[model samples]
Target chain A: MPEHAILREVGLRDGIQMAARFLPTERKREWALRLKEAGLREIELTSFVPAKVVPQFADADALAAALPELSGVTASALVPNLKGAERALAAGFTHVNYVLSISEAHSRSNVRRSTDEAIAEFERIVALKRTQDGRGLVLGVGLATSFGCTLQGHVDPDRVFEVAAKVAEGGADELIVADTVGYGNPAQVKTLLPTILAIAGERRVVCHFHDTRGLGLANVAAALDAGVRAFDSSLAGLGGCPFAPGATGNINTEDAAFMLDSMGFATGIDIPALLALRRDVEGWLGDERYSGAIARAGLPKTYATAPRTAAAPALAS
Target chain B: MPEHAILREVGLRDGIQMAARFLPTERKREWALRLKEAGLREIELTSFVPAKVVPQFADADALAAALPELSGVTASALVPNLKGAERALAAGFTHVNYVLSISEAHSRSNVRRSTDEAIAEFERIVALKRTQDGRGLVLGVGLATSFGCTLQGHVDPDRVFEVAAKVAEGGADELIVADTVGYGNPAQVKTLLPTILAIAGERRVVCHFHDTRGLGLANVAAALDAGVRAFDSSLAGLGGCPFAPGATGNINTEDAAFMLDSMGFATGIDIPALLALRRDVEGWLGDERYSGAIARAGLPKTYATAPRTAAAPALAS
Candidate 1:
């Protein structure tokens, strides 16, 4: 088992993109800085998508330029296509995440491309990264709808691994398997994550689950049992599934961090600080549905006065 | 691994007791019959508390009488003391559940008894059941705050198992471990449930978790992995923690059943009927903070036409 787990903050990117209101660039930067202060080492700063499509991310370049203020935090951005990758690279982001749907039907509906076309785009993105003159840019591939899809349900594990193999072969720095529509359960996670990990190898695999059906943390538990140590979560659980409106959003970062810390996984996260940010997000995104339990009930008294480290260290193994 | 899992619906007793308005007797009876139609074999009908104290269950006798209408469902009632036990048995309920808090503080505050006194009450309840000439009633012993307590903080696992042993020795028909305040995590469930099952044996141990901190289904997964096949849940995720206002309530029956069924655990539930009932509850408890994600998102299309059986028998082993 790994000594420390990595939680990549995706609120600024994935979360704000789905919001009903436009979050100012300054608030986005503030959210990032607070995340850094809360001990988030990796932060998905923003997405380099067309401003007309996702106006919330129009400040993507501005957020990327402000990353220098968040010292010690490794900043990353989402790139939807070759054009987005160009923008991300121009913004000087060292880490770029490119997503492709594992289900062919979802791929066509979501990214407006077939699975093969997406894979070919990934190859082009990798080639673009390789040709960057003096920049050491790394590209991460996220397999969306890896569990099941809203457009085409029951995505095959073999299909997910097939895309995973292509991502690995395409010289990607990270391989993330996402239950984009929250259609996954723990059984699928335990059964499929290990195979995905085998292809991605150590320190390269990530799990992203939405809480659309209230199994986000359960899926996270299964992935952890399958030896996954990295996950993507949104602050205040900001991003509700587009497919399942009025349902829960992405897995809440504070809640997931608290669970991991309670279970003796060293998350290096300041849960109290994250909880404080949850309150701020609630204020920032007024009337936007914010879901998570720890923010309401508070932490167990056992965690009080304890060091900000994994509690029950012996249990981690 | 068991061929089928049992989900005891506690919506009537536990869920309605916490609601803002009193649910009428007919509504309670309709809820039970609906639960039976949804394939629940066991339902906690109502508590045998004083009508003046909890007016919601003032219809305990009326509900018990209506249980005959639910042909295939086992009707159970909550009995807090020897007085409640007498009432339950007099009402001809075959299954009676008596709760004793494992946390001394919670026991003193909630039930107005010390832990030792609660155990003594359990002994008395068992004695009462044994003395029933030909009633053949079964007594279920529930250890509330078995994981942790809001007032007492960390309830020791050793202390919980000690009470489990006492319940087992007292000749109770069932042993239920409940996280009353939802302070438990997956690691705690995985660690404690096996010890609980060791004392109670198969088909005798039950896990009751609240989604207070959004770890309800995660804890369910851990308990399932630990070989627990019986769980207690409420419809539409009704019932908040009396101790923690605004906290999540009991684990949602539909969500837990869906996860277990998707994971190849034979839950034998009619999910669509449950989902429909959830909408009714949402309307029934107007502005009462109803929850559970599956009711909004609906089940995956993969499970759309599949029979209400375990999807994979091999993985369960």
Candidate 2:
């Protein structure tokens, strides 16, 4: 396993998508800027879906256009199909995540397409990324419900491997295995992560987890032990599984960072800054429920970054 | 790692100790009985503390005497010193957890004794457990703040090992490493658990963690990976560090059972029964803050406990 891990803040994209009220374009831009300021090197800023269906992300183009100003940060956007990919490319987004529900039932309900159709769409998105001029866009194929599905119950691991093998053969830059409804357990992660990594190769896989069953961080630990170096988390734990009844939000970004950093994995995140942003986001979305423990408990006193060493005095007292 | 793990439900003792409203002695006994109904073989029923400081457990004697009626259940109580231990013996309790804060500052604040003094008391208690006639009692020395301390900040691991060695040599039946203030991370557990276990022996070490920072279950995962088989958890994620500001509560018992059972570890727990008890506890402790995601999300659809195999049919449809 790598000594470092990358935690991609996906609150703006996944979190806002499931929210009850829409945050304005200006607030979304503010959130993006604050995320960058909080030392997030990579962030999924928005998704290019139908503005009518996901009105909250109607400002995806604007957010994508504003990414150039934040030169050091890698801005990512979720694209559902070839049309979404084109818009992402037009807006100059260098990273696009094309998500597909591995379960056929979830695929039809979520995207109005079958699993094969979604895979075909992913191939087209990858093709679009290749054809773009002077653009270094990276296309990642995300396997949603890769662990299990709420609608279909237990998804066969063989089917997940089949989809993963196809995505790998399709020439995507990255492969994402997501427990969309948080049906994964640590044992499953311990067993399946190695297989996923074996097919995707090193540095090609990202693990996305939800706190629906409170096993999000445990699954993260399992993936870490399995040598995964990148993960997806949301600030303030903002998003929940729309299909999984009474599910909580995504893995909390600050909590994940705290766990990783404390475990000696260098994540390059300023946790206090993320906590500050979490506070701001909490204020902005005032009645909406947000979940994360670190925000409530604060960091441990033994937290390494909190200026533990005292300054040397010129003369003894 | 052991194929079977024991999750000792400590909510009645630790959780109710911190609550604003006091559960009557009858409710406490009812909670204990329900814990057994939920398939928890071991439970910390109450604490033998002064009623002036902790009125919630004022009926410890009554609970202890009543525990004999709950067949197949190993009832335990928290005893602070020799006096409490004597009371526990008089009440005919067979298991006692003698807690001592490993951090000097925490030890002074919690029990008004220094670390060495507390260790000396533990030695006395062990001697008492050994000297008693016809009392087949088991004594566990719980080293609270073995991970980190809210008052003293970073606790040295060397101190923890020293305490473990002393308790092991003092003839205690078990050694408990407690993250009293929830400052522990997985790396610490990975490094410290083996050392503690080596000193205490396999199945002789118990892990006590708080979800104050949300790593409670993650820490449990770490401990499980380190070959430790016993854990301490609460009913509705109740109980917080009285000394640690903003700390949430203990690891939820239902959450722990779900994770362990799903991971193929036989905890001998009926998760649905625990959830039902959790609901009852929630109703009793109305308006109090409790945490646990499984209660909200319900069990996974792929959960196997409910008659997974289909009965043979005469014909197919």
Candidate 3:
């Protein structure tokens, strides 16, 4: 059987970033705590960006204040630049995730920098994390547009490998491969993930995929079959890119958890609890175009009885 | 590398069966032909059932009359009993699909028969297929709720295997394992599909899966990796079970074909033409809540340059 997978909740950071309105600081804290209580060991609680640029994380400091109350949770926040990394450390986040796009056009349009410039920023953030105040901070790197880009179309695997090797050599504590524009497929995920893992050596890796083309869960399955054990998902499938108009966002946390648990990976998620939280979150973020399947179909009748293990015959081969 | 997979369009039959309103006969014929024009070789054109029961396929005869004009296309019709199969053969359908639920509860509620009775009915149908009028007809059997059932929940694999063995031995030309309510996951699929193939021996097999829990394409990927080809999909992911409310239907025909093509399988689907037809179909089926990723995100940037094949390492192993 495959190992237990970590499903890090990103609804607060990624999902909220695309929402039309900002959730209150306290509500964000409460929701994060609820997610942790519902068996998430890690949570990407918020992002450190200029409030004027993205108003959703305007109260990042206030939201990060209650991280200590999360008990055994490993909380991380997104930092767009070195200054944002500084803000993240100052706000009591011991882990920070820095994102960089691989596609030149996506880098220019999304982060207002070229791909090379984004890599340089990542190196700078690594240096900043080595400073006194940033000591003990685990700096993870996210490779946006690692799979495909809306602006650049198909991203070459050779180029992606080059960037991944750079991140792996640049001292990222973990590597995150993201399908930033939801243009990924199962064949790509199964083929590319092992190469990314080989580049990372011993560093842990996670994938961030979108449901823009409805292949999110299928890609997750491919990754698992490829030996991936960690994933990033949002509650209620709550996130979308500002650039990809009419596109949906990440795979649902509850739905992915259900898939993971059903596949016998031991995600330790409480389906009923997660579904209840999803309902509350839906009410909180009224009319935000929520997505998920288990929330809609209810849990499978055999959910508790027969969680099939991967130790079954070599069926995929 | 994996071989080319067959994608059989089920929108006209399964999709319309679930629609609140019946599609006009000429429009149904036009849509099926348009589907064929977009490179679809097989289509479940319609179902042979009483108009008083379904109302959507009430014009089954009218729709079947145009099958000859399809030229080289292979057309199949769904049948609930031997009588329906007889109707299908009389109406120029060279292929007929017989559906049976493994879940006794589902069988009772769906077709008003027990599981044993359903198997017995399959035997009777096989006898009828050997008769003079049905001599050259191909009798395909669909194992409904083979994965799980909304009524019974978590269908037993042993029971499904027994039914599959009987069907294969009783002369089923094709075996279609169906996730009637979408309670299937990738692991369950990868494990079960190979066993189904083992029971099938030399017979061809297809899968009819719903996206109720968003794992439709994932199941497809698993089945592909398991060496099974041919799937039943509906346009824009249409079709649903009345038993499972809030459940969406099959994987999108265009999206599944796109994934198959991108995965280096020569499905021969013309994405642009299919998308155009989908737009027209969407306009025809207003308020129907269509589902698919390719429709919203469009095609990828690398669609023309690169299509990844399965030979790229043992990623899924």
On DockQ, the leading prediction is: 1
Cα lDDT of model 2 by residue, B1-317, tens digit:
32677888899988878788888777778888877776787888889999888988788988876676677777888999999998988887888999988899999999999999998998888788788746777888899998889899878889899988988888788888999988888878998999999998643788999999999998999999998888999988999777987887889998998898888777778888888887888888776678989989999888877531121111100
In candidate 1 chain B, where is summed lDDT lowest over 10 consecutive residues? B308-317
- Taken over the whole model, the C-alpha lDDT of each candidate is 0.84, 0.85, 0.85
Mark the regions of model 1 whose C-alpha exceeds 4 Å error after superposition.
A305-317, B306-317
The TM-scores, one per candidate, come to 0.95, 0.95, 0.94
Clashing pairs in 3: A153-B301, A154-B302, A213-B293
The alpha-carbon root-mean-square deviation between model 2 and the true structure, to one decimal in Å, is 5.5
- Is model 2 an incorrect, acceptable, medium or high docking prediction? medium
Model 2: DockQ vs. true structure = 0.54
Instruction: Rate residue A189 of model 2 by lDDT.
Output: 95
C-alpha lDDT (0 to 100) for residue A14 of candidate 2: 85
Better of 1 and 2 by lDDT: 2
Chain A in model 1: its TM-score? 0.95
